[model samples]
Target: MNFTPALPKPFTEIWREAYRYNEKDSPRKSSYQAPGKTPVPFILGTTKLTGGFSVDTSEYPTMGYWSNVPRNEKPQTLLVTGYLRGDNYIKERNTLIESLRILTSDEDPGYLELPLWGRFPVIVTNWDVSESGGKNGQCEVSIGLTRTGMPELQRRDTTGVMGLFNKLENTADSLKDAAVLAFESAVDGINAPDTIADSFTQIKTSLLDIAGRIQGSRSSLNEITGGLSSITNLLAQGERNPRKLASALFDSGKQIVDGIIKIRDTFDDPELFFTIKDNVKNMLQQLLGVKNFFLDVDTVTIKQQVIKEEAERLFKITAFSAASQLMTKLEDPTFSQINSYWKLLQDLEGSINMDDTNIYTAVQEIFMTVAEELSSKNIAAELTTFIKTPIPLPFLAQMLSCDEKKLRRLNNFSDSFLVEGEVIYV
Candidate 1:
């Protein structure tokens, strides 16, 4: 039930909340809520700061060694040069050292808040803290941070296409891990072999549908099918260990999803592009559609509840990732189609019927991406204007100031007059 902490805007909402994503002692808090009344400043004070941003890209051999797919936004990297000071040098040095220890080695990522850049969930990929005799009661520190994209039970927001993709990639990975954990938990709670076998059948059916849709895709279908086959055989042989089976299932699911994403790199065909994305999305929906009788029967067990919760989260996360890639892949997307994507996302949210605010955050970022990027190029592409009254075709000729024949052909008008004024697409 953890979320990336809510960031109203990168600079405006600089003061944010603090909560534990994995804390079991207390009921989980919303990622959108600001619980901490005060801001938690970095232990080190900055003297000078440096920052970076980049696009995550893959060179496509199929498109050509030099060609690449639409760039995914890379997490912004930070290099902060700062210092620690205290009345006692040893105490100040120890405090900074311990913070660095957790920053560098911990499995869970720690939050790094810059003065104006906004708070980020980050991993200290590399850092240095040093002290000298000349500089008594103080030490120089330089830290390198890469946004890990994994917010440990916190909400977050940032601007730019880079931030969107960075968070998306991490969220997708997080969703995968959570899905596996939930599946494993469910497997442990329900020991009935028949129930397990039926669930596996449902999984296989979903995978096969996806396999059929992507029949000619460059993705490795055989690999996905092969992994699932091995597990199905093992389950048939009375190998019912929950952990092992769940891990294998998780690997297979990830393999299929990874392969699906990889197919986008194979070639550029708009029709196939949408076909594959839609089919895979439908397969995921089907995967979620199957009713697990075991979950229903085991209502008394809380593990089942976790399984259901994770499934819902997984669904939304999957949709978010798919929408991100789709929007990015387009060279120039129209406001009409962008609006359609918004509708699809909204419908998805409505289907899930959960009151999660994080989905709306992702939606806003995507909508803004289209609006801001398109604003400068051609305002015409984004909006349309029309009248209810009928008008002659020659009326456009005089109004548009274009060559009459060309305008008429472009408008696809069969009659000499338009019954009602329409904003021509061109």
Candidate 2:
């Protein structure tokens, strides 16, 4: 057999010795003595096998034993470390945890696969069976991979580790890309005058809304990492446990697809998907309310009647002057940075001629057109898609809303825009 045995040694004690002397920076040299010095078996030592596999040992400080190894039981704990070049440590740990947690007991332990030195693999165990009689008996039991039933375990674990590593690396790269893209998008939004309205208060509110939406999107993207981790572990065993593997893969895929659906759904129902949309709508409504109040003001008409001695009181309010002041406030450099529409406000006021009915109508139309232009394009498109294709209420309502009545409406709206949110006339 390729495996060799050095001598009978306490597994835990040998592991301790390995740590003290085997470290790269250590000056201590280990020598074997018949009785006084620790004598460990070759299998217990860090053994480099052919085919790029190495089995090793490590020792962690143990907790107080509930009951000591129990009367010559030699119930020892050794950190079994494995080093494999093209393997995944995290995946191995996860698989081993899943497969073996129900099987192994610390009080009377069994063997397990574990990481050593970053990517190394090791078998952990109590390593002694009193019933087996002697060290030879124990060593005999330890011989071959079948005893631990860990060859298949190793196969599964190796696949799992490699898959997990690749997935984690991919997720990390994706998150990095997301960060870069978000930054670029923000820069674009900041520079685009048409995207933001000029008015310090409005611009500030818009910036906050954009920031919130971007943050929400980033958070959604971050959730993919957990989903990916599950997929990696699940798919690694696709060849071994096709059914379970398929289930896991399916579940992960569903999560990603569901997230995309949520994206579409949230856009369609702005009030539901993002608080920012609600805030924007509210702000616009307030602006429209102000315009409506201005529209209601009574202006005196110029009239003269000789027979009836009709008289008219001329309300000489400089409407243009007040409008110019409003425009100037809107065009302030601070607000202009966010939006360019304030530059058109001057044209809006000049268009209003209270004396001419046609001019008055055109002026009001100009202002209304400018205000309507504030709808964000991206938000609008997402909303339109959401309105056309509503998400299933049974699936989404639990997370989106708690109101039963609203949930039903949301669900119905998904089927058809049988009901709609109000339209504010600018």
Candidate 3:
């Protein structure tokens, strides 16, 4: 089967248009209506929120054959409600809004009150913006949607994406690890809960290791995703029919969830987990490929082109200037001190090489000598920070440098404290 992912339109073209839009050159300028010639103000309000059902949970043990088994912990609700803003935007901003009464008028009566997608609560009217800053006095109306919508819409979009893959992967990983821990706990006669709790230490380290690997693999996919999020927001801003895009994204999310569910079902068995992991990885690969294809269109071409180009130019200039400054400071005292040891170490390392047999023999002899010296000492034999020196001269030199010779001489200086002792060697 052909495995090629679909590519969006060219990034350069989209970037060019995006650049123009950002310059504020495309939008129609608002008419300067003369004083005292006030247009009809738009009314902004929300529809009455109807009754809705929500799920709640409580812990309970499994019964009958699984009577001793603990209750499984999980999220209480699968879906939430209340987010409709169709009419509220238009009614609040009469100046920018051409179809002010479309959602609430007789032609579209009850549309404002309907739950968006049988879920989101729709706004019944325009927003109250007298509190929002304007040149006109109080009671004067403001036109257009607020800036807040962008972030809110993005939150929903990204949350959906995360829900599809992130939640599934996390849940799958947890279930797999938990099952293994439970089995081990049973074998070792330990409580399942205690084993699970102990497993967290290893689990935390494993997660950190995975995150480190991912960062190394592609230089932080999370950052890449965040940049893509901005592009998605920009697309949403000028979109004439946002619902179409939202629908497409949501459908894609559903497909991801279906794939995850399959993985979940197979997680218990090792062979199956490996198979499912491979398939899930393939899905992610496809998703990333699709995203990259769209990103080029979204970033390099459209209305955002100028911003991208400017940002690139600024970055190059900044990087070159920083490099030049670093070159100027390369010979500074601080740099010299920091790098001097590094060069010495490199030369030291380059000059040192040993044959395998000689290296092993030398290490063994050193260790044997250390053991012999430690055995001869009457002091307690404990491994501590004070490792015994392999060479007697170096040890004596180090001690002398630290004024240890003076301290030893002081200990032997007093005739009364000397106790007429004779010199002895071990």
C-alpha RMSD by candidate, in order? 19.0, 28.8, 31.3
Minimum summed lDDT over a 10-residue window in model 2 is located at: 307-316
Off by over 4 Å in 1: 1-166, 183-187, 215-257, 268-331, 346-426
Q: Candidate 2 at residue 308, lDDT?
A: 9
Query: Which digits, one per residue and each the tens of the lDDT, describe model 3 over residues 1-426?
Result: 111112213323454443345566652212212112333222222323223333223222222211122222221111111121233543434442333333432122211111121222122245333433443322333322211112345546654534333433333333223322333322343223222222222322322332222211122334323332432443445432322322222222333334344344434455444344333333323222221111121332332443223222222221221121111121112223224422432332223221222222222232233233323333321111222433343354363353333233223424332222332111
lDDT of residue 106 for candidate 2: 22
Give me the overall lDDT of model 3: 0.29
lDDT of 1 by residue, 1-426 (tens): 233323324543323323222345332121100122222223434523333334334333234333222334455566777665667656655655566665332235556665345555556667787878897777777777665554433323443455555544555454445544545654555546554554455554554554555533433566557655756776778876655555555455555555556664563455575465444444444333332212222333565454444343433444444444444444344556556554565555445422323333334344455345445343224433474776776775676564566454335565666735665544
lDDT of 2 at 410: 26
Candidate 1 TM-score versus the reference: 0.39
Name every residue pair that clashes in candidate 1: 3-154, 4-154, 4-155, 4-156, 5-154, 5-155, 5-156, 6-155, 21-153, 390-419
**Leading candidate by lDDT:** 1
Predicted candidate 2 versus true structure: per-residue lDDT over 1-426, tens digit per residue: 111122223323454453444555453222111112222212222432222223222121233312111111122223332221113433433333343323332222233221121111123332221222342222221211111122444546654635443433333233223322332332332332211111212222322332233212555545644554553443334322322332333343334333433444454444445442233223222222222112122223221111001000000012221222222222112222224434434433433223333223333333443343232111111011132334444444443333344444223352432433421110
User: lDDT of each prediction vs. the true structure?
Assistant: 0.49, 0.29, 0.29
Question: What are the models' TM-scores?
Answer: 0.39, 0.18, 0.17
Output the lDDT of residue 77, model 3: 14
